[model samples]
Target: MGCSPTRHRSQLSKLDSPSKLDAPCITQERSIETPGVSPNRKLLLAYYANETTMNGKLKGLFEAIFAKEELEVTTIDLSYHNLNVREIYHLQFVLQNFQNLRELKLNNTEITSKDIKRLYSSLELMPMMQVLELQGNAICNEGIKYLTKLFFRTMKSLKVLNLSNNRFGDEGIATLCKGLLSLRCLEELRLNSNNIYSRGLILLSQTLCQIKTLKRLGLAGNPIDFESVRVLVRSIRSNVNLKELDLSRNGLSKQVKYMLPEGQAVIKA
Candidate 1:
C-alpha cells in the first residue's frame, strides 16, 4: 500500500487522531456506479482509533461533519473497537451520508443479531454499495432476517460479501442461502470459522448449485466431514466461475484429495 499525500494525511490525521486506533481503511471511488461521487469524502475508520471505553472522540468527529448538508463519509469500519453495543448501534444513525458509500466493514464489533434491523435500515440509504463485510459478530439466525432484507434490497449492486466468524448455524446458513439464490452479481463469499457442520454444508451445497457466479468460496476452519463435503464437491464440479475453494481445518482435510473428482485442482485443504 502506498502513502497518502502530505496535505490529505495532515487533514485526515486531525479528524481521526486517536493515537491508538491504528486501523487502516481504504476507500475506492465507484465512478461507473456513482458518477460525480466526491473523491474527498471523509472515511470513518472506527477501529477503536483511541483508548476509550466508548468511541467518544470518533462520535464527536462524526457529529461535526454530520452538521453539513451533504455528509462526506463513504466508509465506516469499526473493526477491533472497544465501543459498547450501544455506541456501535448509535453510529449507524449518525452516518447521515450513505448515498455515496461503496464499502461497509464492521468486523469484530461485538454486534449481535438484534442490531440487524437498525443496520438494515441504514442499508437502504446506501444504494451504490458494492462490498459488505460483517465478519466476527454475534449474529445468529434471527439477525439473518435483517441481512436478508438488506440482501433483497442491494442484491443487484452488491458484488462482494463476507459473513464469516458469526454464529449462523445450519438453520441460519440455510436461511441466508435462500436469500442469496438470486444474487448473481456476487463474486466472492467468505464463511470461515462459523461452526458450520453437515447440515449447514448440505444446505450450502444445495445453494451453491444455483449460484454459478461466485469465483471464490472460503469455508475453512469449519466442522465439515466427508459426507458433508460430497454434495459440495459435486455442486462445485459444475460451477464454471469458481476458481478457488478453501476447505482447510475442516474434517474433510484428511480425505479431501481422494474425495474430489479428477482434474479439479483449485481446492485447498
Candidate 2:
C-alpha cells in the first residue's frame, strides 16, 4: 500500500521589541488575528494557507502578507504544492526574508537541482533552522552537492532531515556523508526508497559510526545486500546512540535481524 502524504502545519511566531505577544496557531482557516490584540501585533502574525494552485493565489498571498513588513516567521510548510518557476522564485524571496526560520517543509514540491542552487543563498541565511524535509522531490546528485555545503556551513543545528525518494543514488550518498559528519545536533535521518544499494549502504555505514547524536535511521525499500548489511551491522554495533534501524521491504531474510547489536532495534523484511 502506498503511504499517505504527511501534512505539516506551519507555525509562525513573532517577537517584537519590549512586550511579547502570544503567537496564534495557523490552521485550515488561516486565522492570524485575535480579539483584544493590538493592530500592530496582529499585523505581525503572518499565515500561509495551503494553496492548490501556484499561479496567482500563492504569489498574491505572499505579497499581501509581506507588503506590510518583513515577517519574522519561524516555520514555513509548502508541502504538496506543485510550484512552477515563478512560484519557486517567490519562495526564494520569502526564504531570504525569514532569516530566523526554524523549520522548512517542501515535501513533494517538484523542486530540482537548479531550484536548489537558486535557493542556496537564502538557505544559508537560516542558521537556526532545525528541521528540513524535502522528501519526494527531484533533487538528484547535483542537489546533494549544494546540500553538502549547507550541512558543512550553516545547518549545524539541524535535527531532523527527510530526503526519501529523491533518486540520489550511491554517488549522492557518498557526497552527502562528506557533509553529514559536520552536523553536531542531527538526531533523525530518513533516506528510504532512494534507489540506494549495497555500495551506498557501505558508504553510509562508514559515516553512521561517527554521528554520535544520530538516533534513528531509515533505509527501507532499498536494494541492499547481505554483505553490506553485515558491514553496516559491524560499523554501528558499538554505536550506543543509534536506537532504530529500518531496513524493511529490502528483500532481506528474517535471519538478518539477528546480526544487529543487542540494544539496537532493526526492522527487517
Candidate 3:
C-alpha cells in the first residue's frame, strides 16, 4: 500500500491577507521536497503567534490558507494552536480539500481523543501523506485506537511519525505496535515522554525487530528501568538497519549502556 512518488509540475500561489489586523496571516511559502517524495511540492508555513487572535479568527485563517489552490499545498504546520471542538471541525473540513498533502504537524494543539477521531477520519483522504507529527497533545489510548485504523487503512507511505509527549501508557503502546507492523516504509518513530514502562517497551521492542525500514527510534523521557532495557536490547540485537536509538532522560545507569548489543545501533541512554 506504499505510495510511489510521481513527478508533477510545480506552481506557486499566494493568499490575500485578511482585512482584520487581528487574524492570523500566511507569513511564508516555499517549495520544498521531502526526502523520499516528489520535489515539486509547495510548503505553506502559517504562523498563528497569538492564540487569542487565532482562536477568534480561525475560520478566516483557514479560508485564506485553502482559498483557491488547496491542491497545491503539500505541507501544513499549525502547531501550538489550542484548537477547540468547532475549530477541529473546521480543520477537518479543510483537510479533505488537500489532495497532495505530505506532511501535517499539529503539535501542542490540545486535541483530545474525540477530536482525533474526527481529524483522523479526514486523513484517509490523503493517502500520499509521508510525515505526521502529533506531539504534545492530549491523545491517550483511545486516540491511539483511531491512529491504528489509519495505519491499517492508509498512511503506508509514512516515513517519519512523531507521537511524543502525548501521555499514553502501556495500553496505547500495545495498540500502536499492531499498526506499526503494517507500515512497510516507516523510518523514524518518536514516542518520548509518554507513560510507557517495562511492559510497553517489551512489546515495542518486539515490533521494532520486524520493521527493517525503521532507522531512528526515540524513546527518551520514558520510565524504562534496567530490566526493560535488557529485554529491549536482546529483542533488537539483530536489527542491523536500526542506526539510532535514543533512550536519553530515562535515568538508566551508565552500566546499562554497556549491556546494549554491540554495534547494533547508536545507543543514547
Candidate 4:
C-alpha cells in the first residue's frame, strides 16, 4: 500500500535566545521555518537538538516535513528549542499529528514533570511508537512516575528506553519501579549516571528479574555501591534472557570480579 497523502505537510517556526559563549550556535530566528502543510507528507524527523548549531534553512526543512499528515516523525536533539514547556507547549500539536512515529529522543532538554505528562497523554494516541530516549533531561521522580505509569497503562509496544544521565535518584526509581512491574516486552534500558543508589538499584534488579523478555541493561555511572552490585549479582545470576549488562564507571572495585558466566561488568577508576 502507498503512504498516506496527509503525510506531506510543511510548517516552520523559529525563536532565538542571546548567547554568552560562542560554540556552534544557531539563532532561533535563523533556525526553524514557517508553517506549511501538504497531503502527500510521508516521513517526519524532529531533531530538536541542543548544543548542535542549526541554521534557518535546516529549521524550515524540519517544519515542512513535520507538518505532513500521517507522516512518521522521529525526534532527536531537541535541545535547540526551549524546554520552558509554557512557551512552546503548543508544539504538542505538532507532536500529536504524527500517527506513524517510531523513535523519539529528548535528551539534555529542560523537560519537567508537566511536559512528561503532556507527552504521555499524547503517547496514547500514537500506537505504533517503539523506541523512546529521554536521557540528560531533568525529568525527576515525578516525571518518571508518569513514564512508568505510561509503560504499564498505555505504551505497550515500547521496546527500548534510554533514561541515562537524569537525576532520577531513589525516589524517581521507586516510582518507575511500580509502573514497570507489568512491562514484559521492554528489551533494553539505559540508566547510566542517574545517581541511583543501592536501594534503588536493588529494587530495579528485583523488578528486572521478574521480566522475561528484557535483554540488555545499562547502569553505568550510578551511585550504586558494592552492596548494590551484590544485589544486582544476586538478582541476575539466574536470569536466562539477559544478554548485555553495562555497569561501567560505577562502584564496582577491581577486587570484585565477574560472578556471572555470561554477563559483563566494568570497574571505575
Candidate 5:
C-alpha cells in the first residue's frame, strides 16, 4: 500500500530524553496491509527512508503509523541523513507506538552507544519483538555488549539479529557470543565486516553448538582467513541446527568450504 500523507493539525512538542519512569513510544496506527508485511507476516520497514522528505516528516509518518497501536514490524535506515540528538530523541517517542513490534532495523546509520541505549530502553517495553538489524552503525564492542545484556535478559522471543559493519572487532563479537548463548529463540545472526578473525569466529561457532534454534549465520566481508574458517568448521562440526552460512568476499580456500558440517551449506568465494 502506498502512503498518502494527511496533514493533521497535530502538535509538534519538543520531547526530552526518556525519564526513568517513561517508556519508548509511538502514537500512530498501522495495519497489516502496510506496504511491507510478507507471507511470513514479518513487518518490513526498508522503505522508511524513501517515504519521508526529512526527519521531521519521518517522525510524523511514524507517529501516524503508531497511533493505532497495531504496528508489529518496522525497518529504517538512518545513514547519511544528518541524524542529530533531537532526531534520536524523537525516535524515543516514535518507538512507544510499537508495543507489539516484532521486527526492527536501523541499518547504515551513525548511531552511537547512547543512541543504541535509548532504543534499547524503549524496546524494553515490548517483550515479544523478534528480529532486529543494526548494521552500519558505529556501535562497537561496548555498544554491542550493552545490547546483548538487554536482549538476552528481555527479548527471549528474538529470532534474528544483524549487526554487520559496526566497527565491532573480535572482542565485541565475543561479547555478543555471551548474549547468543542465552538466546533460546534466535535463529539467524549476521556479523559481517566488524573486524573479526578466526579466534572470534571459533568462539562464536563453539557457543552456537549449544544453541539449538540458531539456523543461518552470516560472516561475510570480514577478515576471517582460511585458517579461521578451518577453526570455525571444526568448532561447528558437532552442531546440527545451522543450515546456511555466508562467507562471501573473504579470501577463503576451496578446501575449507568443503569442510562444512554434513547437511549444512556454506556460501564462499
Candidate 6:
C-alpha cells in the first residue's frame, strides 16, 4: 500500500479541510498492510484483520479509487481487523464516497458503543446496503443501542445481519431482541457465543415468534438449559417458516432434541 510520495502527497497536501473537522476523528493508515484486490473486482474485502492493522494509504489509496471513471465496488469487508474506535470512525471518509455499497462487514474490529454509533451514522451514505456483519466486536449491552437503532432505520433495505461472538450476556441479548422483533425483512441472524442464559432465550424465543421472515438462526455456543429449550420450542411453534435453528454447542439434555421441530432443528451432538 505504499504510495508514490511525489504524486499522491502533492494531490493530498491539504487532506485536513475545515468541513471535515466536525466528523469523528478516526484512525486510518496505522502501520499495516495494503487492502489490495483486483482493480476489476467488485468487492473490496480483507480477512485476518485481527493480526495486523487494516490501515495503509488512507488518502492515496482511496483517492486513486475515487479518481477512476468506473466504480466497481459494491461490498467492503474488513473483518478481524482489531480496529480501535478512532480507526473505525475514520472510515466514514472512505465510505462516504462508496455510496452504492450493498454489504459491509466489520467483524472482530474491537468495536465499542461509541464506535458503533459512529458506524451507524455513516449508514445514511449507504442507501443500497443489504447485509451488515458485526461479529466478534466488543459491543456489550450498552453497545447495542446504536445497533438497535440501525435495525429500526434499515428495516426496508437490510436483509441479512450477523452479530456473532460479541458476548452480549443475558441483558445484552434482551436488548438485542428488542431490535430483532421489529425487522420485517431480515432472513438470517447469527448470534453464536453471546453468553446467552435462560432469560435471553426466553426473550429470543419471543423475538422469533414476532419476526416472521427470519429463516436461519445460529444459536450455537451458549448457556441454554432444558427448560429454556422447551420454552424456545413452544414459543416458535407457529414459525413453520424457520428453515434451520442450530443449537450445536449449548450442552442441552438429550431429551430436548425431541422437542425441536423435527426437520428444521439442529441439536447438540
| Clash count for each candidate, listed in order shown | 1, 0, 0, 27, 16, 7
Compute the lDDT for candidate 2: 0.74
RMSD of each: 9.3, 9.2, 10.5, 10.9, 11.5, 12.1
Candidate 5 per-residue lDDT over residues 174-267, each given as its tens digit: 8888888767898888988888887888888778778777678888888887876776766666657778778877877565667775567655
lDDT of 4 by residue, 20-42 (tens): 22232211222323254433232
TM-score of 4: 0.71
Question: Which lDDT values do the candidates have, in the order given?
Answer: 0.67, 0.74, 0.74, 0.62, 0.66, 0.65
Better of 1 and 3 by lDDT: 3
What is the Cα root-mean-square deviation between model 2 and the actual structure?
A: 9.2
Candidate 1 lDDT tens digits, 142-199: 7877777767776457778888988576777888887787576888889998878899
> After superposition, which runs of candidate 6 have C-alpha atoms over 4 Å from their true positions?
1-54, 57-64, 69-72
Runs in model 4 lying further than 4 Å from the true structure: 1-62, 65-70, 74-82, 86-88, 263-269
On residues 1-269, what C-alpha lDDT tens digit does candidate 3 reach at each position?
11111223223223224674343423334443334322221222232222223343454545555454332467766787677675676677557656578888889877777878889868988788889999988788888888989988988889999999987889989999999987889999999999899999999988888888888899999998888888887777777788888888998848466665677678887
Better of 4 and 6 by TM-score: 6
Q: What's the distance in Å from true for residue 146, model 6?
A: 0.7
Extract clashing residue pairs from model 3.
none
Against the hidden reference, what TM-scores do the models get? 0.75, 0.77, 0.77, 0.71, 0.73, 0.73
- Cand. 5 Cα-lDDT: 0.66
